[model samples]
Target: MFKVYATTPESMGPCGIAAHAARAEAMGFDGLHVPDAIHDGLLLAALALQATRRLRVGTSVLVAFPRSPMTVAVAAWDLQQLSGGRFELGLGTQIKQNIEQRYSARWDSPVPQLREYVQSLRAIFDSFQHGTPLRFEGEHYRFTRLQPFFNPGPIAHPDIPLLCGAVGPAMTRMVGRIADGMITHPTNTPPEYLRTVCLPRLRDGLERAGRDPAALRLILGPLVATGVDEQAVAQQWEQQRRLLGFLYSTPAYWPSLELFGWQARGAELQALTREGRWQDLPAVVTDEMLSAFVPRGSYAEIAEVLRARYAGLADSITFPMPQDTAQDTQAAAAIARLRA
Candidate 1:
């Protein structure tokens, strides 16, 4: 069984995020994983950590390519200090178009680049904490400058955990080799895919690096349909269908589908996106596929379902906070069960 985290919804601004974090803490969630999509992840983390007393605040993934490692290190360091060691920084490399066009950041050689980014962050942390003289030279990034006046200097907690979002083998392997943890993409967390592809690849990297597999946190952020009753559960299942319809449209996420002989369905979803048939997309995901991916049960039983599904695989799992505040009590009860 794995501990549950509140997966903070995307597109929320500062106040909403703080409120959500406070609510999650009140509900007994061990942590909140905030997104870096529409807003600054670091800023959201600051608010989330400040608002909550005991809940861990982490960026589910803050895009790594757009921001300099030095900038991220400083922000993460400060958040760790302020949170009394409950801040985690999860990093990711966005696709080329978004990285280059949307963010206006140079994008090339992502796996290596991300590997270097993690290394660079660690080096910067070392310099900041112990004054070890920052010198991380890699193809994508190089940092050799750190004046004593500019350095933020040591904090009470210097061993900040660095997590990464990874789906592909290379990125997953890199995560095992370097990062403190790996957060699975929602589409890539099906048990068979993880057992066959992800865990093995991660172990390869861990073996190469001579790091213990137990040290790597494998968090499964799967889609689960939970509610007080069947009707409410159905609503969540439908929502997941629409979300998956949008997500699988990206070919980059097709490998998991390919493993399950659903690659053609992924292509079909992509075709619908290309044809701009957004409304029709959800219909493409059949009930069979939905059942295969999502766990659906009442809040009272969903924890057992998750345990049966993910035990011995994921070190932690994420369960979404209910969209309606009315459902908070049931959702909170479910989280408590998961934690226990």
Candidate 2:
């Protein structure tokens, strides 16, 4: 069965996260994927976990560079313990400009930095689990001390499944080499992009690491524009198109555009952003480009469309909760079919 996870919108209020998670569980979703956008992702995850008994909570992902590995490990450990081993830690390295400017965090070579981050987190978790010495020295990060006094010793769930977000080749390969699983960024979640670009690099990494092909999990969070009917789908399409226009403007996410010979369109979007033309961004996203990022249909058939599109491609996928609670059953039906 392909697991289906619930995702929240960027505009959702913090107080709504718990209610959303409860609804997702009631709707039969396997898990909830929270974002580190307007609200702290872990805090939101805590809310969700507290509100639901069985639904797993994970960060779609949490930004890694801005916080220390040990700090993050401690939080993740506690969340895992609290969730009864239901928490998955998914980390992502935001692009340089966002890291340096928006986050006021140091930005270096991200592939290696994130690799070291994941390794250091495991080393810390190991020490916390078994009374062993904590020593992980990497080019980007070094952790040689974990005094027993400071160490939050062992939880029942010692193995917190470490997931990484990846879209580029270097990052995807690194994730396959180190991550227990990977969360595909929305911009890079199309079926063709996964088959032609991501899977090959991932296999190369898995081969390099001498790991079993099936051991690593791949979760595709593709942008989907589906609703109860044609009118609803069209509304969702427009919303997703505007979102894609904003996302593809980032050069790091342009690999998908390049794959489809739409790099020029990507550049045009970027130029619009550079000129501070925020309102014009949506206009630049044509139907053709929108179709690449978002698969459109009614909820009645969207699951079949996705199943056929990603049949053997992904182990898990993300489905967002509808803004209106009235349409949840319609969305839930699709989620159930995907999970089946």
Candidate 3:
């Protein structure tokens, strides 16, 4: 069956989180992905888990650089156990600047760091499950012995799935080679690019690792806004476009957007940023750009578009809900239509 996953913004208020999770669970959503940004992802996940019983709660991504692997392992394991195995730990290595400036942590060689991080997490989980001594020494991390005091106890299913949020070829392949799934970023990737470029790289990596590509889950991340008012929806899209435009102009994000033929607009977006004319973004964003990136329309139209766009490649399509609106009703209605 095609799965439907909804994305929760990083800054979602407590009421918003509870309301969305409750509605999504009632609406029969497959999962709820909470993004990791300037907020505490684990805290939010705990809240969501408490709020909904059936829905699988996940972190859209928890940056590896911010905290130690041991810390992440314990928290994820605890959450999984607490949620009755209804948790997926989505991991990612954010850009260097965020890692350094925001998290106040070191950033170096993400691929290797990611590998070691996963390995360490697995080791910790294994130690708890099999009652074996856990000791791992990698270039990035080392653990001679993990105390039982730190263990979160056994889970109904100790094997918590790890999903990596990656975009570049190396990271995409790495996700295929190691992670249980890959979560594609929304800034620039189109559905076809995921099917052609990202999926192929992932498949090749899986082949090299003697793993089946079909076993890996593919998650398509897109900014979603749905409303009764078309003009309001368009304005929301414009705001999203400006934010995405700024992201597109960045060195890290530019490469991805450039691949999707969005590089030319980078200069104009940069100019907008320089002049503090963000409100003028709507005028500059062409219809083609909106079609290629942001998904906008009435609830039914947007849901159908998402279903069609994701089609066969993704196991789930994750749509982020805006904060200002009453998303429960719209989300429930959309899910009912999509499932039907």
Candidate 4:
């Protein structure tokens, strides 16, 4: 999971990110996923690579609409080469509002647009490795020029895996066809959602691409709120409820709410957010809604709960950090149990 708490513009320079990465790696996280909200995801990926020795690093998503495919390929290639093949390139088509308003970028046909984006990156990487002239022209992206001076030219690790952050079926299928892995939106995914909605779509995508089912990884991160005791669990749930409310405020992320027949609640939250009523948003998410998404238990039981819920389903689950030094020891024990 991302250390997004420390990822502010002031603090997330090389030193700050390196410290967080070192701490996370020391805690035995297998990978660091950089998020794309306040900070640049690609830049965070680079910093993570520079900071850690053994841990893998990737973007939860680098927004696809703002950056060209060639630019992405260049950065990912350098990170892969520098990190000795431990870089994963994860992309996403962010919501239309963010694309149009936040970035001043155009947004249309995200599914097909992202498909061509991934294709273009692959084509560019291929040209760099094989010395072939880059010639990929799709409806959304065109890359027909690559001078020798521009190409980074054949690193030790050319096959950097491309992962996509997706919630919808069309995007999931596109990921299965072209991407190496898929990151599920935590708000839209629970264990039941994975078994029913996510896995089937992934299978269909793999079948459509004529690829092996085992080739793609199903990455999931349930909202895990683990604590040492009852009081801590209560506090964690409160925190998670606020986060859930914020996510449900986005209409694009209403699938899980829809599943619970709380789409109306989501609409109400959206209206509150539009009126700049951020303080009132958390009230819209009921305790029942919070329980439906987040898994709350003691630190000792959380790993087993996750394994039982997602065994044979998720290739990797996001590692939740313990609150204190005492819980950290317990958390490590839990991680060992999951590995076993």
Candidate 5:
């Protein structure tokens, strides 16, 4: 089945995460994805896991560069065991500035560094599971010590799945090679981007790893604008327009915009941002641009659109829940037919 996931609402506090999880489960959501923004996604995932019985919880995704591999391994390992193997450790190398300035951490070749990071994590998990020595030596990271005193020992669920959030081809290929799944960045995607840029690189990586392309989970978190009425669709479109303008300002994510010869548009947005003209940014994102990022339609039309766009390409999808009760009901019905 193609899994349907709902993102954890940022308005929820620590105690509210559990309630949100329970509600999402009742809504027929297959899983819950907690994004690492201002809040601690790991702690939130734990809370959600503790609350729900069958719903899978994942960090979509946690910033990996800020923490050590051993630290991530321990957290995911414990969570996996606690959740009876329902925990997925979704991680991402969140750009250079966020790592260097915000976290006060060093940043280097992200793809290779992340590859080493995942390998180190797997090695540590291996030691915990099989009582082996912890000795993982890599170019970017090294973990030669895991004393018995610090070890959590073996658990029933030792093979914790690793998911990576990626946009660039190199990082996407790395995900195909080393990760159980790839979480595509919401702002840097479309069906065309997936088929042309992401899939080719991923196929090459899967071939190198001697793995099947169909085996890897491709999770899409696209900006979707769907509603019961024109007014609601317009509201969602406005929100998506502002978001696209903000995201397109980042030059690093210009490839998707570049595909449609909109590199100049990205540059214009970047210029506006650098000039501190925040209000002017949204004005630059035209309706045509908004359509590229967010597909606008009625709630009843969404399922067919999603399948026509992402069928066979994506294994899962994450989107915002409609605020209108009747619209939400129709959307739920449509989403149920996504995998069928």
Candidate 6:
């Protein structure tokens, strides 16, 4: 069965998390996914978990640099226990500025750092399950004596499915090797790029690790904006286009867009930033740009587009909530069409 999920908008504040999760469950969505941004994804996940019974909750990604692996592992374990084992841990290495300036952490050798992070998480879980002493010495993390007092004890499934948020080849491959699934960025990657570039790298990683690629779950979060009014839909599309333009302009996000035949536009977007043309972003962003970056239409039309876009690859589809619509009614209508 294809699973549908929802995200609370970045501007919606944390109070919307429980409200959205409740609507998602009541509307028959399979899961609730929260993006890891300046906001707290785990806190949102906890709220969602408490609000719904059957809906699985997870972060689209929690950046690796902001918090230590041991700390994340403990929190994840506690969430799993509290949520009755319905929590999935999604992790990523965010760009340099967010890591260094915002989080006050060093950003170096992300691939290696991520590998060590995953290893440490697994090691901590293993120690809890088997009552064995845990010892791991990695470039990014080291743990020698894991006190029993800090341990949350074993979950029903001690091995929580780890999902990596990946866009490039190295991270894609790493996901197949170590993660149970992957969460892809919608604005940066097209479906064709995912099939031709990202998926192949993932398969290669699974092959190298002696794992079956077919067994892995692929989760996609397609940025979507739906409204009952056509004019409102157009305005929402423009807003999303400007937002994506701002993101693609960043050097850290350019690689993903470049992979999908948008290098020149990516460079232009970046140039706009260099010139401090922030106000002119909407002018540079065309209707074509908005359509390519996000699915936008009336609720029914958007649902159909999403169903088609995610037809085969996505085991779960997460749509970022429409900026112009009422969350509860829009969610109910979209879920009705998606499940139909």
Best by lDDT: 1
CA RMSD of each candidate after superposition = 1.0, 1.0, 2.4, 3.0, 1.6, 2.1
lDDT of 5 by residue, 228-266 (tens): 867788898998889888888888899998888889999
Q: Name every residue pair that clashes in candidate 1.
A: none
**Alpha-carbon runs more than 4 Å astray in model 5:** 323-328
| Cα-based TM-score, every candidate | 0.98, 0.98, 0.90, 0.93, 0.95, 0.92
CA lDDT for candidate 2 = 0.90
For model 1 the TM-score comes to 0.98
Indicate the TM-score of model 6. Answer: 0.92
Model 3 C-alpha lDDT per residue in residues 55-112, reported as the tens digit of each score? 9999989877788988888888888888899999999999887889987898989988
Winner of 3 and 4 under lDDT:
4
Candidate 4 residue runs with Cα over 4 Å from true position: 1-14, 323-327
lDDT against the true structure, per candidate, is: 0.90, 0.90, 0.77, 0.79, 0.85, 0.77
- Model 3 pairs in collision: none
212 Cα displacement, candidate 3 (Å): 0.8
Tens digits of per-residue lDDT, candidate 2, 173-244, equal 998898999999888877888888999999999999999989899998989988889999999999898999
Number of residue pairs clashing in candidate 4, backbone atoms closer than 3 angstroms, sequence gap of 3 or more or interchain? 0
Task: Report the lDDT of model 4 for residue 293.
Answer: 89
The segments of candidate 6 whose C-alpha lies over 4 angstroms from its true place after superposition are: 259-261, 322-330
Q: In candidate 1, what are the lDDT values of residues 166-272, reduced to their tens digit? A: 98889999999999999999888888888999999999999999999889998889999988899999999999999989898899999988888999999999999
Residue 311 CA error for candidate 2 (Å)? 0.4
What's the residue-level lDDT of 276 in candidate 5? 95
Write model 6 residue lDDT over 1-340, tens digit each, in one string: 4677777665444787777787778767778887677678888888888888998998888887778887888888888888888899989998877799988998888888888888888888888877678999987789898788966676686768888888667888888898889888765446666667777888998999999877688887766767777877777777677788787777666665665556787778778888998876666666666666687778758778877766776677776554434555765677767766
Candidate 4 per-residue C-alpha lDDT over 1-340 given as tens digits, one digit per residue, 9 for 90 to 100: 2211111222355545676666667766777777777777777778888888987887877898999888889889999999999898878998998899999997989999999998999899999999999999888889898889998898998999888988887888888887899888878567777777778888889998899988987677567777887788889889888888888898888887777688999899999989999999888889888777888878678777777777777778776666465666777666666666
- Scanning candidate 4 in windows of ten residues, the lowest lDDT window is 1-10
